[model samples]
Target chain A: MARPARRGGGYWVYLIPSLVLFLVVIVVPFAMNVTTSFTRWSGVGTPTWVGLGNYAKLLRDERFWASFQHNVGLIVAMAVVPTIIGLVLAAALFDYIGRRFGTRTASALRAAYYLPQVLPVAVAGVVWGWMLHPSYGAVNQIFGLKVNWLGDSDIALATVMAVMVWFQLGYPVVIFMAGLQRADPALHEAAEIDGASWWRRFWHITIPQIRPEIFVVLLTCTIAALKVFGPIFVLTRGGPGSATMVPSYFSYLNFFQKADVGYGSAIATVLALIIVVVTFLFLRLQERDS
Target chain B: MRTLRAPGGPPGRWAVLAALVVLAVVMLFPFVIVTLNAIKSPAEYSSGGPLSLPQGVYLDGIVEFWQRVDFGRKLWNSFLISGTVALAAVVLSVLNAYAIGIGRVRGRLWILVFFLVANTLPQEALVYPLYYLAKQAGLYDSTLAVIVIFTVIQAAFGTYLLSAVLGQFPREILEAAALDGAGRWRTLWRIVVPISRPTLSVLVIFFFIWTWNEFFLPLIFLISNDNQTVPVALGVLQGDKMMDATMSSASALLGIVPAVAFFLIFQRTLTRGITVGAVK
Candidate 1:
């Protein structure tokens, strides 16, 4: 069919505005950030080049490493734990609750679970902060313990991670629900007819069917964890010292707070690069599966 | 429905529902607490249990919060800035997506691909440069600048989404219109647009919610109190009086009201919208 000669101004017109805007907003800024990393420039005045100094300083920067490690932990937590939990929740909903409660009620319940995703990060953080306030907050009262959720360096990152998981689960759950909806009912019925147990069908058939959705969720969650700036910015602000510092926070501090625009740009560039590489790898895996 | 009871007994169904309800409660707890606290007097808020109700209903806390937070100006600012941004972005995206997605002229494959790539780049990567650019253009501390920057940043994704929706549209309809002597513009307005109403509605809701909730762009672009969006205003209100629980709680409630309203209205669509591309 030769794709029916492919329709409207094809590539040029459609590409121009988006391409120009993106190049100006994304590509140019990214390049500028790389250049800034190499030069020492405050938010004001002209810049002077200082080759590899920022990277060198970053090499010995314990806080930078701490932030980087936290990002890795975040990505892992977002991917592994949430994926399992979301899958279980989705399976339970699809196989049990959803079918009984009726589709409308099931969807309403899903919307309730997904409500957090729509909330502003600032609001989410404050609400969580209030809830986790060590002394007067709900968490302490509920648990009958006086542990400072944000003040304690040891638990601060963990606290941040927990909030992140809670707020983000809604999106993944919806995705899993959609995947479950598309699954072939006949496979389950056939397995049941053959005397296959529910667990066996779920393990051998259900999991494989939704593998693509799983990969998509993992990729998004990882990327989200890597670029988590807003929630951390609002909730802990890198916390009782650098406990909750992630790469995004580190970059923000370097650029805006410290006025080390160059080093900050470098951090931003590295983070972008990491995201691109991760996304590329994810796409490749999907391609292979297809 | 029959399949459910056939395998898992009623107990199993109840157990699942209970767990889901527990998770739902966890999700809603903060909003509930904040609402209850916002209505209480400061002393009442500070002294009462976190989950307890107000001893007496009082608009005083909300009134005090409104004054301290300059919430009237903030709400106005949010409405003006976000409304403009959403409108501009959606309009531009509709034109762009229609042209590129359906009109699929000679080079659209590459353009479509470019847009897809553009959609994935982190918005954080663009902030500093945009900041400097806005400054140079004398847009520093202007609400207009925030509106424009957000509109531009959002255009790519809006195009990406609208195009996906437009892609499902049958080309034969457009072809039929074209054969009937309709020009490209007419075909679009008379044919493509009307059929694309559902997608457009979804985009409208999507952009409205996103622009309303957006924080970073406003934080970076609009520095003045008069120009600040709701999120920035809330942050500043917190910074200004960290101790006033009544004011803080009230401000939090104000900030969430619109989003909560939007969620309630479009609960079904919003969840689907959120998950649309996550698995694809």
Candidate 2:
């Protein structure tokens, strides 16, 4: 069932353009960034090598630690919470709604959920920022409360998290719903005939059926949470006094705002390392499971 | 398939439907509020609060925002950049996938993995260096720089997906093409590409949307007012203390229009593409 083997050396020509572009855009710039992390530079003068100095400083930097801590919160908001809720919503839409209400209702609901995902994150930030504004904001106007959504340091991160949940909820719903389409209806019908509850069937059949998608969703969303910047930039700017700062925005501030390019590079390098490790761990777990 | 309802059908099912409707409304609440507010004058908003219906349609805020941001120019920049990146990245992906998938070039697995990792590398890791280099190359604040950068980044994902799809290409077709004396380039254009058009179209659409939504790189590189993309322009304006609530809502509405249009137009393809990309 195999095709004839082709001569391979000449094929390298096809790869040359892509390879060159990769080197220029990703490889070279990434290498330079890592190298820059080892030096003290203000984006102007020659870089002075100061091996591990930026990393050591990061260990003692309260802001750096706080930013990573916020990333943990974001992980919960963007990945963990969304996956749980998405699983249930997807099952309901696929199994319950599609059966009773029809596929039209199910898809319409899915599209409504997916609306935020299509919008640029910055635009989403604007929408939420306006809605949550303390004075003239819609939430306050509707609920008749004076709670400051983005101003108070205490409530700000939670507000941001809630907005992120809104922004991220759609992704897992869409993916899990798609994965559920591949599940055999007979399995569910057989379970139902035996008096297995909806909850039971969902646990036994649905979860296991969509495990690959669950892994994919969690991995991608977690990575997105870690690298989240646009929302922070537009909504909170990592403050009312550094309350909602995340690593990506923190690094950006260092690079552009504060002119500490070396430290920024170090922060970015660490973030890149963490993301790679997380991805590998997920792949390894997926491999072990299958 | 037999239709099976819950034991308590009407009450339980209706309750579930009601809850889902509520959730969907909650998800859409912001857009609803923004749209309501965007059409109200400041006087009307302050008097009626955000919950009140607008007395009359007000286009002044949206008009003001458009003029202030030169939004037409921003839209053109976004369209041009995303359009170019989509076309260029698809071409790059096809070429690379050809070598690795159909050609089965040496070390293809390693090359695929390299692309996978490259795709995962955060923009932060490449941003500053790219910034400096762009500056050095006298391409600072140029749309060309952004177009080039995203072309490579998006192609990484495209190449990864396309390689797998092309690898499973029924070798009988390639063998047949060869039997007829079709060269590599000839076979690729006349046979391989046409067969793979569906996947390539998916790649083009995904690349365009992804590039359209990109914030970090464009935010850094496209610094000038005239060069900024839609998201960046709207974002930068968000920090301005002078922007009134009506104006901001107007801005948000403007930003959302094109994205929602794209989503509605390409909803089917986007969903199918997402599933294929993720599961594969």
Question: Using DockQ as the measure, which candidate wins?
Answer: 2
Per-residue lDDT of A70-171 in model 2, one digit per residue for the tens? 999999999999999999999999999998889999999999998999999988997888888787788998999999999999999999999999999999
Write the residue-wise lDDT of candidate 1 on B1-280 in tens digits: 4755467555666776888888888877778878887888867765766567788787787787777657789888888987787877887787778776776655666766666666666666767887888789898899877777677667777887787778778968977876787766676779887888776766777877788887767877778777888777775444343546565567778777877887889976776666565543
What stretches of model 1 exceed 4 Å from their correct place?
Answer: A1-11, B1-13, B239-241
Give the TM-scores of the predictions, in the order they appear. Answer: 0.92, 0.98
Runs of candidate 2 with Cα error greater than 4 angstroms are: A1-6, B1-8
Location of the lowest summed lDDT over 10 successive residues in candidate 1 chain B: B235-244
TM-score for the A-chain in each candidate structure: 0.91, 0.97
Can you give the lDDT of residue A271 in candidate 2?
Answer: 99
Q: Write the per-residue lDDT of candidate 1 for residues A173-282, one digit (tens) a residue.
A: 78888898889989987887899976788788878989899998988788878888777777778877999898887888877799888888777777887888888899
